[model samples]
Target: MHLDNNTNSEGQKREYCSNGASRGGAKIIKTFSSRNTTQNLGNNRFNNTSNIGAYENNPLIKSGRVSLDKTYNSRTNSKFNNMIPTTYETRDISIVFEEDRQNAKHYDMLEETDDDIIVTGTNCDTPICFKTWEDMELDPRLMENIKKSGYIKPRRIQAFSFPLITAGYDIKGQAETGSGKTAAFLLPIIDKMLKLKFVSMRRTPYALVITPTRELALQIHEQAKKFCLNTPYECAKLYGQLEKSSLNRELDGGCDILIGTPGKLKDFTKNLQINFSKLAFVVIDEADRLLEFNFANDVNEIINSPLCTPISKRQNLLFFATITKELERYSMDWMRKEVATIKNKRENEVNNKIHHNIINVQGLSKNKLVVDLLIDEQKQAEESDLSLRKTLVFVERKKVCNILALMLMNYGIKSASLNGDRLQKDREKAINEFRSGQITVLVATDVAARGIDIFDLDHVIVVDLPKDDFMTYVHRVGRTGRLKKGTATTFYNPETDYDFKDNLIEMLQNLGQDVPDFLQQ
Candidate 1:
C-alpha cells in the first residue's frame, strides 16, 4: 500500500502514512528516509529523501511511464482500468449553422445585462426569502398538485429560480440537489409546454431533460408529470436497457417532454428517431455529474445539435450543487454570454453543512475500525428503538464492495454491493430492496453515489477516502445528513494524518457543524 507522506514547515518528519496491516495481521509502521538514499520506483531510482522530494518534477512514474493529469484518472488509477483513454486535441471547424450560432452568442452575452438580471444586485446583499413562483402564476392544476404533494412553501433556491426560469431567462443555478431545484426548473417548462399549441408529432418532446443516472431521470420525469397533471402535456422517460419497441412507439406517437441519460439519447439521436430541433427548453440536471461520468463529449454533441441551437438563442438551464473550475470553463465556452448565476449560501451556520476531517491513520486495521463503528451505530439504534433505515457504505473498488458486503452479512447485518459489474436488473433490485427497508446497508461506488437521493438515509460510511478533488469528498458526504437531518462518519486509518483532516474540520466548522474529537488528533 502507498503512504501519503509530508514534511513540516521546519523540514521535520511528519506522520504521512495510512494505518494499514501486514499480511500476517501485524500493523506496519511507515517512516520517511531522512538519510540520502536512492529508491527504485518502477524502473528508475531517485533520491527518495531529497528536499525537493523523490521523483520531483518527473512527468512519468519511476518506471518512466507517462502520467496523465486528469484528476479522477490520476487519483483512482483509472488509467489502468478498461476505462477509455481520453486524448486532448484542438480543432477548427466551419459553422454551417452560422445564423443560429450568432443568435446563441448574442443571448449568451445578454444574460449578463444589468437591467435584465434581477438576481444580481439585490440577493448579493441578503439571503433570498421570496415566493419563487410569484411571477410564474402556474396553472391552477399544477398548483393543486403541489398542494396535494404537501409542499407548502418554496425553498430558498426555488423562490429565486422559479421567477427567472418562467421569465425565459437562461440560468446557471448552484444549489443542493434536494433543495427543490428539480421542480424549480421543471415547473416552468411544464407550464410553458401546456400553454403552447400541440403540433401533431408523436414521441418528440418539446422540452428535454438530461441527467447522469436512469434513476434520477425517472425521478425527474415523475415529478414533471405530477406538475403537468390534468393538462394536455405528457412526459416520457428514455434510458438504456429498456424495451426499445415501446420507447420507439412512444416517440412515434409524440410526447410533450423527454427525460433521459446521454448514452440512450445519443443512440436515439443517431438513429434519426429522436428530433431535437423542436426542443425549446433544455435542462441538464446534475451538470457536474455529466463530466464525472465521462459524458462530457456526449453532452457537447447534444448541445451542438441543430435543435439545441447556440446558448444565446435557446433557453437553457444547468443545475447542480457542486461546480468546479473545469465546469466553469466548459460553460463559458458553450453557454450564453449573459448567463445568470444564482449561488447558494456558502458553507455557513445557517446552512448547517458538515465536512469530514482527514485523520491520518498509520498502520491500523481498516476492517477492525469499520466493524467498531457499525457495532456502535447498531447498539445505539437498538437502545433508541429506531428501526435502522438504509445506510450507504462507499468503497473505491468493486472487489472491496463485494468483500465488505459479505463480511457484513456474515455478522448477521444485511448488506449488498451495488456496482457497475452487476447487471442493470440486479442493481435496480438492490436499490429497491434498500429503499423499501429490506436491506439496511448498500455498498456503492462514486457513480451510484452521485445519483442516489434517498430521503431519510440513516447514515453514510466512507470505507475509503477519495483521492480525487475535495469536491468529491463533499459529494460523498453529501449523501448523508441530507437537508441537515442525519449523521456521517469516516474511517481514518493510521497512514492518514491530521493535516487534510484539519482543513476539512475548519470547513465544516465554518458550515456550523460540530467536529469529532477523533479527528482533532
Candidate 2:
C-alpha cells in the first residue's frame, strides 16, 4: 500500500558554506618534510592554518590535502613548498566539528572493543567460493535460463543456499542486500514445482513468497517469470493496491507460485480468496525488514495463514540482510533447530556495476546546499544528450522530498514525488515512468530506498547527510547501483568535524570503498 504522510509546507532552509570554497574541485594532499630544523628556530614550511599536522619525535609535519584540480594528484606522495612558512589558519571549521559529532555516534554504537564482534547470525569465517550453475547440478533448462540472463555463476547466497533448498531442507540465508538472495530460493523452488505433474487445489497458491513492499514483490515476480520463461511453471503477483476481483480470478485459475507483500496476502487469505492447502515451500524475502515494528503484526499473521503452512512440516526458507536481537529470537522460535544456516561473505562484492562519489561542501545550511547540488546535476544532465535519465534523489524527511520534487518540476525537470502520501497507483506510475525514461527524476523518501529495485539507473543523489548508521547509507546508495553500472553522489556539509568524517570514512573503508578527500575535511 502507498503510505502517505503530511508534507512539510516550510520552504527550504537557506544555508551558506561555512567556508566560501565550492566542493567542485578539491584535492587531499599528503605532505612530508625532512627533519633538518634547529631548535628555537621556526621549522614550519607550509600553510598550516586551515589544516595542521603535528610531528611526533620526527621533527617534521606531514599533512594530507584534497584538491579538485584535474592536475592535482592525490596518489602522489610529495613535499610542500619549503620556501613558504607553515602556520595554522582558520577556515570552515563546521565540517571539522561535524566529523567529531559523527565519530562520537560511531564509537557509541561499537561494542566498546577494538575487535570485530559477531553481531548476528553465525559468522562463517571460511572463504566462500562461488559456484557455477553447472557445478551445482541445476536443471539444464534452468541453467540455460541463468546463462541467458548473463548469470554464469551463482552469487554467494545462491551458491550456499540453493543446494540445501533443493534437498527439501528448511534453511535460513543471511547476506547483504545486493547479494542475489532472491535467485537462490527462486531457482530451487521452480525446479521442484516443475517436477510436479499437476498443481493442487483451485484458488490455492502452492508456493508463497512474501516481501515487505509491493515494488519488491513485483521485482521478484518479474525475475521469476524470466527464470520460468519456457517452462510450465507459472508465477503471479498478488498485492492489495490492485483490483481484488482480478487477483481472485488468477488464484481461482490456479497459480504455481504466488508473490506478494504481507498486508495484501493476509487480506486475501482472510477473505478465503486464496488457498494454501497444497503449499509446499514458503520463502520470506527480507524477512528481518518485514518483521520491523511497522509490518511485524501483519507479516506474522500472514505467515501463520493456512496457505503458508502445509499439511505436514514444509520447506521454509527465510532470507534477511541483517537480523537484530528481537528478529533472532523470533527466528529461533519459528524455525526448527536442524535448519541449515548459510551466511555468505560479501568481500568480493563491489558495484563494479556502480560509480560512487561524495560532494563534501562546507556549511550549516544542509537543505539549501543540497538544492544547489541537485540543480547543478540537472544542468549537467540537460547539457548532455539525455544521458542522465532515470535519476533518484533521496531526502531525509517526507516533507523535504515533496518540496524537492516541486522545486525540480518548477525548473522544467519532469519529476514526481514518491512517499507514503501518494496513492499506490501514483507510485506505480511514477516508478514505471522513471524506469521507462518518461520522468528523469524521482524525489523519494527512505521507504522507496529499500524496496524498489530500478535497473540501469543513471544517478542516485543523497540530498542530505545520512545518519551515522552505515547500513542506512548503503540502502540509499543501493537504489541506483543495480546489476548495471550506475553513479551515486552523496552530499554533506563541510563543517563536520574531522573525527566525524573519519568515522564515515572508516566505515566506507571497511566496506572497501575509497572515501573522497573532500568529505575528510
Q: Which candidate tops lDDT?
A: 1
lDDT of 1 by residue, 123-168 (tens): 2464343453444577777776665554545655677777666666
TM-score, candidate number 2 = 0.69
Worst 10 residues of 2 by lDDT: 64-73
TM-score of every model? 0.70, 0.69
Clashes of 2: 44
Give per-residue CA lDDT, model 2, range 1-521, as digits (tens).
Answer: 01111112233222211111112333222111222222121212222221122222122212222111011112243332111111122212233233223333323322222111121233345523336677676667776677666554565567667667776667777765455678889898887766665455566666789888877887788777777767766777888667867787766654778898887888877877776777787788877777763677776676676555742367778887665787777776556566777663442133333455555434323344444455555566567544445778887775556545544443345566666655566666667666655567788887676756665565787776566655566677777645444566666665543444765566556645666645543
